[model samples]
Target chain A: MKTAENAQLALLLEVAGTPKPGNVDRERDFPDLRFEHFLAGTVGAGPGLRAAEEGAPVGESFERAIAGMSQQEGGNTQFGALLLLVPLVKAASANENGDNGDAGGDAEDAPGRLSPEDVTRVVEATTTEDAADFFRAFDHADVYVDDPPEDAAELDVRRGSDAIPAVEERGVTLYDVLALGDDADDVAAEWTGGFERTFWAADRLAELAGSAPASATAAQVYLELLAREPDTLVAKQHGEKTAESVRVRAQEALEGGPEVVEAFAESLVADGVNPGTTADLTAAGLFVALTRGEVSV
Target chain B: MKTAENAQLALLLEVAGTPKPGNVDRERDFPDLRFEHFLAGTVGAGPGLRAAEEGAPVGESFERAIAGMSQQEGGNTQFGALLLLVPLVKAASANENGDNGDAGGDAEDAPGRLSPEDVTRVVEATTTEDAADFFRAFDHADVYVDDPPEDAAELDVRRGSDAIPAVEERGVTLYDVLALGDDADDVAAEWTGGFERTFWAADRLAELAGSAPASATAAQVYLELLAREPDTLVAKQHGEKTAESVRVRAQEALEGGPEVVEAFAESLVADGVNPGTTADLTAAGLFVALTRGEVSV
Candidate 1:
């Protein structure tokens, strides 16, 4: 109980205080949750914020609030998502309202719903995203991608960034969860599996990029591989119409221009192949594309 | 330089995907910077997020990327803040463009703004926030909150709770800062000087509560003591409302009158007194008075 209280107080201080040097050295002081939770939560909150800003139904209000949050200046999809959860957690912990199985009121007004015990439980559980999942479970909100309105997106980002460090130590990968191969739907399972897979894929792509000569084919192969992944956010941003346009523009810009291809390739090598950025950019079809879809480990 | 690159890469990996727990414990992986800089730059990205959500400006677009991070989440605001500074610092070092102005578009897009040599400079810099501050000094965005909002006053209950550890460490008294002979603002000035001052003041208030008998006089004294200083968010929250309304509410709610006062004092003693909360409550008159202005404190 004391630990829970301490943790709560610590979190409040962290949120309210300046990001100091002491926190970097103090393991216990960092954000205790996972990074994706921040991303998804903030992104998720985008929808909720839209609702609130529009004065929609309470549920709708929450959804729009999340969406509007994503559009705001912060639009840190991850943090915005978590901030949306705060109210949900506070409400869900309420005494069932004696009727509608949902949460009740604020933490101060509603005691047992979010008790010291619950806070402790959250602390004991690692990962920012996981804590978000638990809160989601408690609140029973679903995850879908309708593209949280711009402002909602911004708010989600703010909240996610604010709380991403807590679970930095959990070491969970998004690619692994994605590699669970489309069967995973639940947020927790899908997120973890996808993280692992993204890493694995990113690593493989980097290796492939290494051997291939500086050519458009190599870039195309990298881009194709990145495109195959199934993260909705990635899909929406990269595989959608805008992404296709960017890819075509980039491709056309280099077509029949062997000199440009070589120059771009040299730049890639000189820059030392940041696999993550390359993969993301490839997915987004910003500049280079890889010819082959399959990469060997 | 190597450390800066590694820290930057680490943050990119961690934020871009799911990071590993093992990676988080590896302190050497992250470059040392001042805490304040980190708060203002990377972790301070919170403002960017807020701006993004509100659609305030184009510069906030960068902030949208860092939402959903915190000490509790795997976001690693500490490292992320540092990483954010890399580009800025590198831009400073890369003067090839001959453009010294701090416009995001002009400098951010400049070729070779961030380079291996600049990365090295950042790595060699001591203190996390300071490293971050190096980048921020050039781009001084007003992110910190200097005063409470005018319409709604803040309530800082956590200050009371935070004072406990400091009080235990330093055997000092609140009277040291108060010096009773001076004016109230002077008392406030000294009281808010540092952690020690705040802690001593809270401790002294707790001690006074313990000694005073449960009565209207005791409550009045509590109000007076709280009124002497108001530094936290909680105190700010009370500043907006009329003091008389607050006093009347507190006075009317005391079911057992003096007995209630005694019980409240006992709770303070037992809990080690949370000056942050108590002070705000007292000032608001929620804890003692019925209306704002009825009680000066």
Candidate 2:
């Protein structure tokens, strides 16, 4: 329950953080997607999050979370975030139950309550049915994705439920499906690479916590993450070149101070260059930090 | 689950709404309370809300909710709101299970999913233990309240857990404790008076749903509510005359238009006159509306 609660709080905090640079936050809303929609999405996703905490299969829980989350007016408010969170939540629950064995060394250890290896184990255990469910979940919301490489056309996420047959026929696990896109998708890379970036960002967030407000801590972590990588959603919507430029701008904004970061945020929004994937990653990191008590209310 | 989900959504929506005069909303926060704190409070209150859905006693659920809600850094974000929500959620759960019998009429009826009469019955059936728990809950947070009448000093909420003995000795139910303050507290009035204002405001929200953004509809309903009555929190903190003047200003702002309402909201925040109780009522109203499908994600 604590893990699920913290995951939900992470969604709220990520969206509430200001100067997030081209992402929806308390102070800014895209024309079609308002802050209230995110609030509704967070509320809607609760039962599914609880499902994850109760040890439901990651794919089923993620699919359920996305279905509920898409009920809000905003389309796809937290799809990528939930993709990262559901498995993490399941892993945290496993750690609590000592299902992780020695992977999570001590239950009482604050920062190690959730182990990246455990999350990787959970994802790697996904079945073909999980991959099919992931495709079905994609149909629940309109998410942006670049065209898949020609060889992987049968497994394109954009095919939504239509590609489920191929996924089942090929016996592709959810991890396998994500691994296919790991090169271009940061979220997929996290799934295939033991959640490397998510854990790193979570550590950064832990270090910044208590020195500032949670939202400010989140914003700093967001800036750091955005500066470090080209946001996949931005890359899909624009191009890799534009996404790389946004990363450079994020780095400069971080070096230039708060006012410059605010200005960079304004420019990105004005240009319709949303680093949505970075925001999603930040939410995931927050969930990790929260579960470890590195961040608290 | 639906009842609890709607109740949680109500808390989020109430805080996310903009131009809510003198109260913390998406666009405004008191110096001591950032928007993130309310988000945290909402998340913290989830377990207690789920308890209500599972038929936990109203007092225990309310106390549990407060204990969790006060975990946030902002001291008190939704004390009055939860005071109204706990019994209402319990009533909704009972209605769902057909425990409300003929009082709630048919199950398929949309707006009749929760009955005011049922909520009143639920509150009226509270035990002395409930009153003790309510006082114990008060010790969890710093809430603003006027001193109790001289004759009822033993019942003072400011006494927190210290007043529990008097409440227990008097064999006061939670309803009785609230009834004693009904003349001064709008939230108490709702409890003892069959939740009349809450139901009325819910109907208003129902009428306004889908016409605009949910937040805008909420802001409009908030203006109407503030215009109709002096906010109890405002009256307690700033005197009856000031509270009434604020009410008059709300009425004028409603007539004067959105710009006027926004300006009035700024002025109230500037003056430190927060209509917190009115905001609580709005949240209760949103919960009722959400449960009835009058409002949706």
Candidate 3:
């Protein structure tokens, strides 16, 4: 429940976050998904995400959660967030699974010390059906992702669940779809790189959250991450230059300190720029922090 | 589930709401109860609040929910809000009890109408133990209700459950305690008068929530109500005149429209003037709206 609840709370905090620029906060909504949709989707995703604690397969949990999200009005309000969460949720619950015996060999660390290999194992375990469900989730939320390279085969997200048949015919696993996008998608990068950035951000969030309100801590962490790198979602939606500019603005705000961050938020919203990938990262970080008990659920 | 979820969601929305002046929003935390405490408290109270649908006595539901709230760090972050929500949540589920047969006599109000008389019935059903538990909840949350009237003789809230013997000796019910404060407390007034304002605000929230996000709609409703009259808690903490001035300021902001409302929010927070009772009202209104299926849960 901690894993699932933390993931849900992280998503809630991410959406409730103010002056978060372009992403849907309590004050704004995207044409594709209203704020309520995001909330509904997050809540809807709960039971599926928690199954990891009960030793459910990682792919199966992802499929259930994605199917649940699709039932909401928005096709994919938090697809990136969900993708980031699946591994974290599963990893957080990995220890509960370890109750049978020691799947964990690292006695130096605690029972569920998240290792890069575990992430790889979980990702590689995803089935073609999981791939299909991921594609089907697109029907519920039109999440921003780069167009496949011209050499890539047909895979329109708008096809809903129809594309699942093609994926199976091609024997393309969910990992294959994510591998193709890893170069341009932070979420996919998390999967491919053993969630390196998520672990790092989670550490960073742990250090920063103690001094501020959780939401404020989250916003600052988001701005810090945004300043560090251009958000991939922004780049996908509006070219790399625009994404860089958003990052530059964040960097500038950071240079001026916390007070400037609020002004930065207002201006970003005014300019219609959203550093969504960073927000997603913040959520991932929050998941990590929550799992580690650095932040309360 | 919607009843429990809506109740929990309403509490989350109330706490997450920011720039609404001096209330304990996500950005700020009261010394005794951090914002996270409220979130935890609300989530903690979920199961108990949902029992109303199972034909649980209103007092039983209230007692269970209050006990749940006490288990959280913030003993009384939402004491008034929970008090307001108890009957409202139960009333929202009132129709479910009708599954066996129809107890709903008012068809004009629709499928699940929360009537004043129903609220009264719920409050009237409380036993001295319920009164005892209510006092115990104070140990968890130090809600700001006025001191017992001079004529009421030993009705101290600080007595914890220890005062239940006195309460029983006096034969004073929970309804009697609420009735004692109805003249000066909006929540108590709702209990005594059949929740007229809650229903009215619910209607307003339904109208406004259509065009705006739920939190924004809730904020506007809070301001509208605040503008109309002084908040009882604000009046208790900072005197009636100060409360009236806060209402006047809200009214002034209303005169200038939405943009001014934002500025008014800054000033209110700056002045440390919080219309908590009205915020409580908005939360109640949201509960009614959510329960009625007028607002998304």
Candidate 4:
């Protein structure tokens, strides 16, 4: 329950951070999605977060979170964030239950912690039913996506529930589904490649904690993450070239100070260039930091 | 769990609503308390909310909520809000359990509803231990209050744990503790007066549910609430004449339009006249509307 609450707090903090270039924040909103929608999404996602904490399968919890999140007026607020959070939440809970040998002790006396290896084990254990549910969740999320690679069209998430048959026929577990997209999707890559970026961001957040307000720390982590990599959502929406340019801009903005960063944020929002994937990764990092007690409330 | 989530959401929504005169909202923050502090408080308050759902005693849950909420840097983000929420949450859960005869049927199939009488029962059943805990919660909350009335000096909340002896000596239940302050404190008045204002605000929120954005509806309800009565926090801080003048200004702002309301918000925040009690009442109303499903996610 503590893990679930922290995950929800991560979602709230992620959205509440100001000057989070090109994404919704307390100060900015996309035309169709306001700040309050994200607030509502955080509230709606609670049950699914609890499901993950209670040891439900990752894909089922993700689907449930997305379904609940869609109850808000906004079409999709935290789908990608939930994708990263569900497995992390499950792993944290599993660690608390002493599933990991190193985690042996009175669980109540020790804080829950997360490791890439623990999360990796969780994704690897996913069944084909989990893949089907993952696809079903896309129906509720209504997230923007480019056309799938021609070869993977049969497994495209845009197919929603219809893609379940192909997933089941191929016996593709949730991990398999993510593995197929590992080359192009940052979130999927995290699942397949040991969540290196998420952990790195978490470490950065821990280092920066208490130096500034929590929202500022989160915003800083977001900018640093964006500077480190081209945001996959931006790449999909615009092109690799545009995404790379955005990353360069983020790096320059970091050097140029708060005014420059604020300007960059405004420009991105004005141009409809939302670095949503970076935001999702930052949210995942926050959840990890919160669960590990690196970031105190 | 749903009831607890809604109550938490109510806290989030209460803080996120923009143009709320003299209170921390998305666009405004008091120097001592930033927007993120309230976010962290909402996260921190979760365990106590869950305690309420699990049927913890009202004062014990209230103390637990305050202890959790105090983990944030802000001194008192939702002290009075929790005062109203704890018993309401207990009552909502009790209704779900069919403690109220009219609440028959599968609890899962029916949304939980709150009634003044039901909440009154929850408060009236409180024990002296609950009263002691309620006083103890004030230590963690750090809320502002005027000196106690001359006759009730022994029962001052600022005495914190020290007042427990006095409370026990008098055999004062939590209800009795609240009843002592009912004449001056709007929050305490709700307890002894059967939550009339909370239910009325909930009905108003239900009436305004979909006419605008949820935050906007909340702001409207807040303005209506402020215009209807002089805010207790304002009265305590600036005296009755100033509080009544603020109320009159709120009424004028309502007739003067959004720009006028925005200006009034700025002026009140500038004067450091926080209508905190009004905000607390608004939060309680939001929780009631949310639990009853009158305000959809």
Per-residue alpha-carbon lDDT of model 2 for B83-176, expressed as tens digits? 9999999989887887754433454433347767779879988999888889989899999887787878899988989998898888888888
Tell me how far the alpha carbon of residue A61 in candidate 2 is from the true structure, in angstroms, after superposition: 1.5
Tell me chain A's TM-score in each of the predictions.
Answer: 0.25, 0.96, 0.88, 0.95
DockQ per candidate:
0.02, 0.63, 0.20, 0.52
Q: Provide the lDDT at B184 for model 1.
A: 26
Candidate 4 lDDT at A280 equals: 96
- What is the DockQ (computed on Cα atoms) for candidate 2? 0.63
Looking at model 3, residue B131 earns an lDDT score of: 67
Fnat computed for model 4: 0.70
Q: By TM-score, how accurate is candidate 3? A: 0.81
- Considering chain A alone, what is the TM-score of candidate 2? 0.96
**Model 4 residue B224 lDDT?**
91
lDDT of 4: 0.88
Pairs with steric clashes in candidate 4: none
The native-contact fraction of candidate 2 is 0.76
Best candidate (score: DockQ): 2
**Any idea what lDDT model 3 has?**
0.71
Off by over 4 Å in 4: A96-98, A101-113, A146-153, B96-98, B101-113, B148-153
**TM-score ranking, best first:** 2, 4, 3, 1
Supply candidate 4's per-residue lDDT for B203: 96
